[model samples]
Target: MNNAPQPHHHLSSDEIDLFELFHAIWKRKKWLIGCTLFAGLLGVGYAYLAPQVYQVSSVLRPAAINELDALNRSEVYKLPPVDALAKVGARLESYEARLSFFRANPALFEAFQRPGQSLEQSFEAFNKNAINLTFPDPKNVDALNGAIRLEMQYPKGVDGVAILNGFVDYAIKLEREQVSADLKVIVNNRLNEIKGKIDAARANYETDKQSKIARLLEADKLKRAQLEDELSAVRLQMKVERSNRLVELAEAISIAKSIGIKSPTTPSALGAAASRGSSQVMRTEVNNQKIPLYFMGTDVLEAERTALEQRTNDDFTDGRVAEIRKELRMLDVNREVEVLKSRSKEDIFLRDVEPLWAEEARLRGLDIDMSGLKLVTIDRMAQTPLSPIKPFKAIIIGLSLVAGLMLGALIALIGHFVQARRENGPFPMPDRHLPHPQKHTH
Candidate 1:
């Protein structure tokens, strides 16, 4: 006989009582109401205890056309666009920069009531209510403007008006310093470049002048050497010519004596010149006397020799050679340096400083005008805010009521199930001590 237990149609106590869900909630109505009221009271108390924050704010607009035009009329140079100032402000107030700002300005947290808290916590709290810069939505294409609005919460015990003014002052100070530093850099760079040009020009002039002088000196030296060589040759030629003339005069006298010509001039002057040697003969001419051909030739040669010696001496004593040496000695290598040094650096800087001067004045004027606008004009100066922005009372109460009702309902259902399980007998136990039960058959 096949022994198999038939599947029993059954419902366990653990099964969800779908039809009785409403009745279960209705039975626990008192508990749900009690939980809802308690949660609502807690919400109201939180709203009462939260600290209130008050905001101080200001607004800025681009420089108007009239303002810029007025400044232009007064100055030769034009002022920079207003958007530049706006961009700097935006950069200073960006998310990353804001973080640094809070850390830097600890006084922004001086209002906190919590004692013994780390400055780290104070800085964190200040960040929560830190300064903000808002711009028009990018989506509103036509509405986009250069106007910026600044807002920050007032700290306890510190004057809100003073803080707002301080921030504006700091921003303007920052812009001015940046402009000054930029101008200084530009001016310094330009001056350095000019100095470099001057140095280069002076160097080039010196090099060229030195090279020319060197060449001139070399040429002069070569010419002087040549003159010395020519003078030596001239002296040698003069000596040979003097020897030949003496030999010719001696032969002519011998011939004259053989021909029986007797003259006092020939025997006395000519014989004396021949016997004493030509070196001793100083007279260039014999005056007022009838002379022989040999004597005449001797006089002519003496004159020629004297003239050659005078010419050679004159060449060495020439004024033009002295002039060349004088010019070389007086070469002024520092002419350009002296001229350039006469002009000071301040003079040069002032000469080119017109534009930078104008720019600085323009920025200063703009800053002054901005200050007249009450430092960007307060948008909504902080008043003592009577109410806090956080822990919205109405919202908290509503949420708490709903949450309590739901939680209470779940607990009530779970309790109901648990009680039912307790009243019912223990679930059929599977005994590990006995062998597995065969399929039960009637």
Candidate 2:
């Protein structure tokens, strides 16, 4: 007490002992091992007992974007669509359209495919939904036909051959037409997006042209060193290549001449003048230019025409887009002539780009192409189980009981250890921490 300060309160030792824990584990070793092994076996059995699931998948190549981009850039007042929402909407719409077309005709589906077509083929053609299609062979016609019908029996209920054929055909056509119709709104939406992009491009081009018009006129008014330089370069190149160009032109003309015989332009007006002909060389001028059929001699007409031609031209990659664009270009231009060559290089490009004004509309059409939806099978076909997959009461109860037994063994071991040590250690000296018997009684 003199050397150090006396403790205000005494501390008590913890009751837990490691020996008891180890002893308990050893005593119930069989229960612990048996429970673990039982749980593992139960897990394996449950995994295998679960039902198998069946799945189907379809695939397709995505359409090109650059072609649309090029179309957009060529327009007067529009720009290419960079919006993700617009694109996703378009893609979704496209998928919807495909699905609509797929569902349109139940009859067509029946007609398009039958049993024995496939269990699982790598690639199968679908008209609308996932209906398969294969040309029916004559030998297999009866079987094929049976496979598609809702019932194995023909004529549905009644047995009139004429009535049945008519009904079946009518049903199929109705289905197909309905599919197209169902897709109409969505397809139209997607197509509209394409039209929108095209329109955007067109609008931008127009804006650009008008904005640049004043500039072009102003430049034209100036001494035009830049234009002069460009003109000179073109002239120089033309001069160097003139002979080869002429030869090429001649070859082109020769090839053109070889095609479909001209009808002599409403029966040759040469009549009596050529009746007395001496072999003096006859100079013939052949009409070899492709002109828009609808154009009269108007600039607007010409613009429209040029637009169609530009889009249809070889430079555009998407065959569908290219054809439509060219058509649109031709539609915008004035009457059919060599008007294409008359315009400067820049003008040509602009005219080509004008059809892109309808890109938004075209995009709208693409958006409805839901038939392009793809699928993948995560799990193969297995019958769905009607009951719950987990909580095996038998296994759970067995494990719980084993756990309880292990716990009991632990308690017993702990009690045994305490009793054994009880007589060995001297009682700790009571100090400030000693509990009063009076407090315990109170």
Candidate 3:
């Protein structure tokens, strides 16, 4: 009998037999089908439980900055640019003010209310899907197309457009109020600083002026006293000269009487006393009688006396010229003080501060229109969506079907391997060639 040793053909696990794979799969077909159908049912039930959501969206266009409009509008209130609206929108997220606003208007947001839930909780839940702000360029904030997009989602029964509009208006108003308050605070601080500087300047000017005025008044008084002293000395000199002239005149009259001449009593009054011994008398024929004429004082002395009298009457002793000079000097000093006071009142710091004060006032007062500061303009209102955006039945079902098939196939493969190991042998290891040991007959 030819009973020779047969060579063993070892198979690696990598060498998969398509026939064996089909046979294993076929053996677990019912289990795989059952797993698939169960997963699909779970998916269908999940889809049914999920609420349908409707989305409402709108676009905001930036308002053009018209120079004429800015001029015509209140000078203190200016509008913010379109790009600023995106920043404002970003700020609106998670703001406590927005929550308070929602609570205040409970009726408007009745759709957001949940039974036994606090207002804060309800509002937070609603915000999860309620609002979104999108910019044209995500990386660059300034590169805006002047269009800000707003999106809101709500349950199937709620009117998304109406709610979105209400929220938008509320947000815009809140943002504007906050911005105005912030600007008012900044402007007020600046104005206060400027006012303080102006006040200090005025105070310093007044203080300096008072010191200068005191010095000027004291100087003027000293000058007036000196002038009075000089005038009094002149008066004493004139009095002495007058008395000497009288004595000379009397003596001359007595001499004429002693000469046995019929002469006027004061005829020699003008004669020079120092030259009396050499004096010459002149005679003139008048009415056939010789008449003698003589002066009461020397020509030089008489001319000096005449000039002194005229000076006393007009300029020197009359005190009019000195009084005029003092009056003019005082007027000039007073005029200078007035001018300085006026200039101090108009300090440059005050001029710079008043406009800021006006702006602060305008911001504080809510009566003024601050629409110019609005960064966002609703270019298109949000439209009410006729259909639900979420709970996409077709997509959800398709994804679930794929996931179920993959899971069922994986479980089936594992079961097939386990069954094979129990019935025949262990799984073949890859990459190694091992021969089955042949039974040897000695």
Candidate 4:
């Protein structure tokens, strides 16, 4: 039953077979080794020939409380140590601050200059990744004790330590200047506010003084009017009384002449009887009634009426009139109003300005000098590094050797397929038919 022999079927070329592929690669082991050696040699050469890059770093921490005591004690401005450290860090990371430092110190960045590159271009390149700031992670519990690290990556010949330390100093100085300027502005603004208040107080004092004078003058005016009215009334009364007295004296004189009386006399019964007999007793009879005007003789009444008529000023007739005249003269010029109006320095009289002046003086005496202020404490100054950070020799050689092995394997596979195609047509042919072995004769 077709036992002659069946041709063993070989695997198709369209599918991959790991065993055959491994076998092919093992056949070209020398080529893989040689390529690996060549690539490793190239890596070593590059590691030695390439320019080295060094890194210098410094650590910054918050300043001590005593270092910032003066600033806080100023009362005008307060700067905490932690915040000061943060500000210094921010300044260090600033592009403008870096550019300013680069421009101010030309010799420090001389290594950054190269052929065909302008000074600006060199600075730009130098500024681009040369400086790095590393802050402590906030999630860590020990972050409070951690510090900010400033690192600078520089090429072979540059003084990285000097540049880093100088940058730190520059940043601190800038922060100090800014703090001092801010303090000055705050103090000056407060001073101006105090000055304005003083001026307003002075104006208020002047206004108050003027108001007082006006009140005094108005009161004096009203009092003078009342006094003048009283004086006029008194004079009118005196005039009317004088007229009445003159009329009375005429009546009395008529009565005295009709009775043949010529002098002031008292009407007594005995005297009247002696002078005019019983007929005079009727006129001389005295009762509880007041004395009659005719009892006074015509000569005395006529003299009193003449005196009253001739009196021009009745001021001496009543003591009240003299007192009113004196009071009116005093009211003519208000002494208090004159004193208030003549005052040149009115602030001294104001009671509200004492505290304000004291406060102004206190503010003026405050010390705003921040020259000795310390913003940050340098935990570690930048030191020159002993070795370069770039060009990892071991890693470079390892990766190159791996890559060369891969490339050599691919070339070996391609060469094996090409040679197979030439020997056995387009695709690789299966194993050829095998010859049978002859049977042994007994």
Best by lDDT: 4
In the predicted model 4, the residue pairs found to clash are none
Cα lDDT of model 2 by residue, 25-76, tens digit: 6776765566556655665555445442222221221123442343334332
Maximum-TM-score candidate: 4
> Comparing 2 and 3 by lDDT, which wins?
3
Give per-residue CA lDDT, model 3, range 23-111, as digits (tens). Answer: 77778887678777877887787777799888988876665555224423544445546545665565555467568668777876787
Comparing 1 with 2 on lDDT, the higher-scoring candidate is 1
lDDT of each: 0.56, 0.41, 0.64, 0.83
For residues 53-138, write the lDDT of model 4, one tens digit per residue.
98998999989999998778877787888788888988998888998999889899998887898878989999999999998787
Candidate 2: which stretches are off by over 4 Å?
Answer: 1-14, 51-65, 73-442
Q: What is the Å distance of residue 231 in model 4 from its true position?
A: 1.6
lDDT of candidate 1 over 319-428, digit per residue (tens): 55555445445442444444443555423333344554555545445422322322122334444446445556788778878887887787788877676667765574
**lDDT for position 217 in model 1:** 58
Comparing 2 with 4 on TM-score, the higher-scoring candidate is 4
Q: Rank the candidates by TM-score, best first.
A: 4, 3, 1, 2
What ranges in model 3 sit over 4 Å off? Answer: 1-16, 27-33, 67-83, 108-118, 127-130, 135-146, 153-160, 179-231, 264-368, 371-374, 403-442
